[model samples]
Target: MWSANAIKSRREALSLTLTDLAQRLDVTKSYLSYIESGKRAPTPEQAVLLGK
Candidate 1:
């Protein structure tokens, strides 16, 4: 499960902002925001990248 809490935690653990993570993931900040807010789910590809 790609939990929002996990995403937030991992980003924090790496000292990354949503912008930073978005840049790294080649996605928009708003898209990442939606994912984090549980308004949307990431694609399998995005999930893999985000998981890493």
Candidate 2:
């Protein structure tokens, strides 16, 4: 499983906003924000999508 920082780092490295990454992952921006902030974790399927 990826840590929250890892997700945020990857997203920022790609120059993507939370909204952009959320759209690509088929998730809500708030949810993605939560994941990045360590307030929540992505589900297994979300993790798979995030890795891509």
Candidate 3:
């Protein structure tokens, strides 16, 4: 299972703002927030994109 904490940590390590990562993921900031908060999971395609 994916860890929301890990994703947030990596994004911070990369110095990416929520808006920045949201743009890269082509998702809304709220949606990304939900992902990072463990309230929601990315779709399979989104997961692939995130993996890149």
Task: List the global CA lDDT of all models.
Answer: 0.89, 0.94, 0.89
For model 3, residues 1-52, the per-residue Cα lDDT tens digits are 5679988988899999999999999999999999999999988888887787
Predicted candidate 2 versus true structure: per-residue lDDT over 1-52, tens digit per residue: 8899999999999999999999988989999999999999899999999888
lDDT of candidate 2?
0.94
How well does candidate 1 match the true structure, expressed as C-alpha RMSD?
0.9
**Per-residue lDDT of candidate 1, residues 1-52 (tens digit):** 7998789888989999999999988899999999898888888988989878
Query: In candidate 2, residue 33 scores what lDDT?
Result: 92
* Total backbone collisions, model 1: 0
For candidate 3, the per-residue lDDT at 51 reads 81
Task: After the best TM-score superposition of candidate 1, give how far the Cα of residue 14 lies from its true spot, in angstroms.
Answer: 0.7
- The window of 10 residues in a row where model 3 has the poorest summed lDDT is 1-10
Residue 21, model 1, lDDT? 95
